[model samples]
Target: MAKYVLRLFDDRIGVKAQGSLPAENRIIFIADGSATVSAGGGAATLAANSAFFSAAETTVTGGAEGAYVLRYELVSVPETEHGMLTGENIFSELLLNASMELEPGDGYLMRCDRVDLPPGGIAYTHTHQGGGIRCLLRGEFHVQTQGKEHVINPGEPWFEAGPDPVLAWAPDHKPGHFSRVMILPRALKGKSSISYVNAEDAGKPKLQRYTIFADEFIAI
Candidate 1:
């Protein structure tokens, strides 16, 4: 399993996980703030623009403030099937493409595809079927799921399933925008998108769609 952590950078706003970089494959970079990461056999202090990869025997702890990190787990991305798109029109442009299985069985499994939405662009709800994670890379979307309505802004994500299937409308989704969602079977065992019961108090969601599926993602 690969662990994803967003060591708080700022007290208020969420500064992104630096991204769920990997421990084995992660860069272990301290972008803005400062922090201490356990390595080899002692503590190494990382400051802004400072990066290292010797935290094999250590864990990261916040200092006076916090640190932003981008983690990439070799076991997670390399083992699991993944596809990505970049630039203005990523999904629609088909920047990158791949296919995978959501479960052991072949049937009842969806293609697990990703597509981009242009401003005022609308993807039929039929395309939103199957279970996956949706991340608002940029801009916002009028997201309505399971009788609940809300706005998914940039740097935010949402998960959907049958019945209460999710629906997103860019009726107001801004431009130069991008969002990505990873589709997976909720039936899959192991680290899931299940949020902590006390996430609300913690002030951050359990899953980071664009990068990390969860702090501790399961492996096959």
Candidate 2:
């Protein structure tokens, strides 16, 4: 079975659509603008800095013209296959949109973590052992990765390739909060899944990092 499936929806103003999820634990990230998402007579608005899991099929109505949503269809791997499987891709279809690539992997362990920061808090420069997506929930965060800076506000989502060093900072006056899902490998399966890099070490060559193969990603 495939590890996960990803689809990007770019909806114009007044667009309404109905769709069903392949799995119950699908994740929906709002990359831009707002949308009214309803299912089974219940509805919620997801915009910048917001995300939610759908345990069933859902209907989505675009909030305005030119809005987009990133949908992740997550599937869990058997622990026996990967030593102990844990986290959760769309690679090609996303190429025209986001600046991320799906890493090579035979299978993946899906893990999600809720992160919170205090005013003036900094996550420091770090890297993940696996690739995944992050969604900002509240407050403000400044994320610098791969030499580009992104201000992740509420309802906005970002992706990391797991090997690149990243710097995240909360504003000096307020706090920051977000959640991330990591799609990691079972090799060295018991490791913490995260690595930290110091400012001074960032410029150094030959920093130790794992390898991800091109064959592991899905071809368009």
Candidate 3:
């Protein structure tokens, strides 16, 4: 088995500026504006809300107006760089890091998706088959897990270790939306990752909707 760390980064590139992304298996999501990513002798333009994956060192050049992006990386060692801003007007923040183990010959998939909940919507107690990092994109929600509770707001990120029971709910007056990148079994590709912990909850009305952005098999 090989141990790995999954990290999420929030980045901003100034107009006409360029930045280098460390070589790793990574998924980059353009949150705002546009940018051009070059890797492996190829370049692609990523507009807002679009994402792409790269397994090698890559360079990103900001568009005429600059860009804001979220990057998720899987690496073999822990990262120590924590600088917030550099001279190039680039800003980077480390949001979350979780350790995991991968077995040889096992199939795995990397998925990025958005979940939306209407006002007062609730995701009853449930468990997932794999773990990943999630970032709240809009509104607010409350999470209960491991005997503790947390109120999550926009821009806040959290990690969910697979198999831990979780219960989340949005406020009665506001809706909640979030984006996440998860590492799951290849068998779950294009399928739901959630499983209700209680039988009764399974029969309840499910109020959350999902929008998948990227789902791809990953080499382990």
lDDT of 2 by residue, 1-220 (tens): 2343332222232334333333234455555677676655678887743555554556665565433555544433321211111111111123112233344344445444557787787766888876777666678989998888999877566777788899878889877776665556655344567666876754544322222211111221
Worst 10 residues of 3 by lDDT: 78-87
Candidates 1 and 2, the one with greater lDDT? 2
Per-candidate local distance difference test = 0.38, 0.54, 0.84
The candidate that achieves the highest lDDT relative to the unseen native structure: 3
TM-score of each: 0.35, 0.51, 0.91
Better of 2 and 3 by TM-score: 3
Off by over 4 Å in 1: 1-114, 127-129, 179-219
Selected candidate, larger TM-score, 1 vs 3: 3
Ranking by lDDT: 3, 2, 1
Per-residue lDDT of candidate 1, residues 1-220 (tens digit): 2322211111111222111212332234444466666655666777754544431433555556555433222222344423111222112111222233333322221121223455775433333233444444456677665678887765454555433444456654363233233333444423333332233433532122222222222333
Return model 2's CA RMSD, one decimal: 11.6
Relative to the unseen true structure, what is the C-alpha lDDT of residue 207 in candidate 1, on a scale of 0 to 100? 21
Ranking by TM-score: 3, 2, 1
